[model samples]
Target: MKAIRIDEFVRDLATLSPKDVPSPKPKGPRDIGVQITHAALTHVDMLYAQGLHQNNGRHVKPPFILGNEFAGIVTSAPPSSSLRPGTRVFGATLGSFAEHIYADENGLREVPKQWTNAEACAVGASGAISWGSLVSVANLKRGETALILGASGGLGVMAVQIAKALGAKVIAVVGDEEKARMIKSTGADGVVDYHEKDWENKVKAMTEDGQGVHVVYDAIGAVESGLRCLRYRGRLVIVGFAAREGKMENIQANRILLKSAMVHGYRFGEDGRQDPTRTEEVWNGFMDLVVKESIKPIIYKKNYVGLESVSQALIDLGKHTVWGRAIVRINEEAERELKARL
Candidate 1:
């Protein structure tokens, strides 16, 4: 089996390389082994490589595999589990950029019949986060309005479609006109270019009666301005800080106090630990959307081939040059099988 190994916490993507590692197997009856086809890259993977979590008391040391989510075929599974050998599945895991991965039955879900492995893999982390924030955390309702900041990026794009699927009027905030057009095509009612000075005001104006939106799904972490775009008692779901340095702007406490608003922070990994049931529900809801063709992952079309390309994928994600999500094709045989079926 081949895996991308990060021998040390270095600033350079050159540290990640393909190495032959022993294949992982199921540890127990509830565990399953998967033959990976595609692995998706996000800013979190880059943060892991740069040791961002290490300073914050996270035990992120070296000589470890470097991917967070994958889609693949089940090679081995216990008879007791619903997933059997040859089942196509996708889900989030700690280290998935490898030929084989071991996961518990609960962590994996069967992919839809229509989706290819690359599309399935593209949805894992971003899909879970989007569903968790809008459906589980915000309890977003139909006919309500949502303002999604950084709406051009991976998580933001998913949030746009999910919010729209939930029957909400979506206001997508992007950095430029091209992104604006792209998000507008995803069913957003309005697109606000955040690069403009009065972007928040524009969002407010687009809402009913200029009151503001029912929820602010902010992934850009522009909390101060995001608050200005919220209606009275609106919920602000903090998804990520991909735009800035992850340092939130100082917000006036009175803003939330006066508006009677609630601030909620969503972390996909933490949600699994805090409320495993809710996490599973979110994944299931996403799968349901897939089954209904209500949502499809917005994947970057460029093919990043093999373990050696993982570093380049990370670099593109860090630079924000890649739109939507980045996927690394790992298994040629699995890829062939997927294409044949399609």
Candidate 2:
């Protein structure tokens, strides 16, 4: 089978390339073999490729495959598992950017009949993260206000739709006028251009009585600035550090205390690993929304086809040049299946 692996930590994207590797077989009673169809490009893949997340304890230094979420058909499954051979599924797995990979039955879910593998792959992890953060972590309620930073990124776009689905009025913060327009298309109540000096003020003004938002979805790592847009007792859910890396420093305790607000950090995969059942609930919930037409993932216009294109996809991800999600078509059959559905 073919896979993209990071043999060593190199600064350049050119360090990544396609290589032939032995296809993995199910090694556990709960494991199933997946003939992967589509893999989504993620910032985590970029960080891991450059060896930036080594000390995080969740991942080790590489010579490892490069994808986290994928949609595929089942080639092999344990007799005891509910999933059978030929089941169409989407889920998270290490080394997902390959022709074949093994994932536990617990992580895989049957994809809906109406969805293409590319659509499923695009929404898989990002939907889980958004649903987990909004519905699980923040407990966002109808009629509440949410200010979503980085509202045009892969996860951000999902966050916007999820927030709106939950009946929260959204104030989307994007990098420029173009992204603002893109986010506005999702029915956000207001859009703030972060490039503007008074963007925070703009967010505050958009909220009820200028009281600020009821929740802050801080993917941008602008926690301090995000705090400025919080309502009393508001929850700040930290899902990523797309804007900057490293721990937030010198934050005054009074900033949190004065607002009587709660600041929480969430890592979707880590949370899912610790509580598999809840993760399944989130995945199913998001899929239900998809089937019901309450929400939809915004896939980027560009297609990163095949394993060989993954390196450039990762580079574009790191540069923040691409919006929504990057879909990588891995198998010819999967591509044909998706097209046939359309």
Candidate 3:
């Protein structure tokens, strides 16, 4: 089997070499062996490559595979999982930068017939993330206002659609004028460029009372300066430190106390990696939105370069340079053609 693996933490994404590894073999009752057709690359992979998340024991420790989200066809499954062979699907399984991956059936979702492989790829991580990071953490309600940073990336794009679907007004922040327009395309009420010197102030000026948005989805935790953009009693959800690495948000506790504000931290892996209930909530919410045509994701380009491309993709993501979810696609033309049929 062809796969990409890291031998050591290196500065270069091109450094991790691709090689042939033994195909994955299935284990006991809960597993499903998937002939992975698409794998989405995210910043977590780059952080893992830089050895930033040593806390996770599952990381590649030299000659190890990395990746968590993939869309594929199931080749085998345990009856207990209720998944059948040859089912078109998408799912999350850590270490999926390979040709074949084995995932617990519950972690895998049956992709809808109308959806393409690229679209289904968004279901696992991007779709699930929108619910977990927005609904679970911020606890938003209809007619409320949300401010989302990094709103043009994989997760941000999904967040925008989710917010609008839930009937909330969204003020999204992007990297530049082009992304500003892109975020607006998702029905966001307003969009701001974080690169602008007064982006936070602009955000404050756009929402009610100039206090701040009712909910702040700060997935790019590199945005402590955006604190001034929060409303009184507004909740801020921190999903990752995309903007700031190893740097404290250093918010004034007094401010949070005075304004009755809330900061909710979320890690995608915490309790939801294999937890049936949390996984179910996230997936169910996503499917309902998709079926309603409320939260349509922008299926960015899917790359056919497998294994070896994972590392470079990760580094590109970490540096804010990836165009979209750079996926290791098993069959390039076939996947695109499937998506086109949708």
Candidate 4:
């Protein structure tokens, strides 16, 4: 099996490359072996590759495989597991940028029959974050208004659709007119370009009576501004720090207090690890939306084929050049098989 292994942290993403590595095996009864067909590229992968993410030298170390979200066919499974060999699935696990990976049964789910592996792979991380933040943490309700930051990026796009699917009016905040236009079709009731002066005020003005939104989903570290766009007693969920260049933000307590707002620092993966039951609930809810075709992965138009393309994909994500989710085709054979069935 060929895998993208980060032997050491490097400043340049271009220095990363794939190498032939031993295939993963099921080490526990709960482990399921998968032949990875496609994987989604994210800013987390870029930060991890450059040793900038907090997980670097902490939760994970060097000489480890890269990637987390992937879709593939089950090559092996426990006899008691519902996912049998030859079943198509999509899920999250470490070292997804490889030909093979093994994950706990709780980490995998059957891919919806209507979607290809490429599309299914793109949704795992993004969908989880959106569902967990809006539905679980924020408790977004129907007929309310939700404002989403970084609305054109991977997680942002999914967040917009999920919020809309939940019957909330969505206001998307993007960096520029191009991004604003791109996210408009994702069912955002209104689009605000953050590059515009007084954009936060603009977002507030779009809500009913200029009161502000009921919830703010901030994936870009726009804490101060996100607070300004919230209604009284509103909820704000912090999912990422993309705008801060992957660094933490200094959120002022006064602003939060002024709005009588509730702040939640949400980390989907960590949250799942702490409560596996909640993980199952979130995935189940997200899959219900998928089955109804209420939300889908917004894949980037550019195609990234093969493990060798992982470095450039990460670089593009770090540069904010890739718009929706960027997917890499890991196994050509598996991709062909998936397309044939589709």
Top candidate on lDDT is 4
Ranking according to lDDT, highest score first: 4, 2, 1, 3
Clashing pairs in 2: none
TM-score of each predicted structure versus truth: 0.92, 0.93, 0.90, 0.96
- Candidate 3 Cα deviation (angstroms), residue 92: 1.3
RMSD of each candidate?
Answer: 2.2, 2.2, 2.8, 1.5
Regions of candidate 1 where Cα sits further than 4 Å from its true position: 27-29, 54-56, 245-250, 338-342
Deviating ranges (above 4 Å) for candidate 4:
338-342
Model 3 TM-score, 2 decimals: 0.90
Model 1 accuracy (lDDT, Cα):
0.83
Residue 210 of model 2, lDDT score: 95
- Local accuracy of candidate 3 as per-residue lDDT tens digits, 76-134: 98767667876787887776777788887767788877777767785557777778778
Q: Which ten residues in a row have the lowest lDDT in candidate 2?
A: 53-62
Clashes of each: 0, 0, 2, 0
Give the local distance difference test score of model 2. 0.83
Give the range of the ten consecutive residues with the poorest summed lDDT in model 4.
331-340
> What C-alpha lDDT does candidate 3 achieve relative to the native structure?
0.74
lDDT of 4 by residue, 1-342 (tens): 799998988788888888999888887889999999999987778777778888886887898899989999989988899999888999888899999999999888888888888888878768877998999999999999999998899899999999999999999988767677779878888998777898889998899889999999999888889998998999999999886765777778999888999999998888787988997888888888988999877888888999999988888887777777889997858757756785
lDDT by residue for model 2 (119-155), tens: 8888777877888888888999999999899899888
Over 4 Å off, model 3: 54-60, 245-248, 273-275, 301-304, 333-342
Can you write out model 1's per-residue Cα lDDT over 217-317, one digit (the tens) per residue?
A: 98877888888999999999998888664345678989999889999999877778788998888888877777788877778867899988988888777
Error of 1 at 214 (Å): 1.0
Clashing pairs in 3: 222-243, 222-244
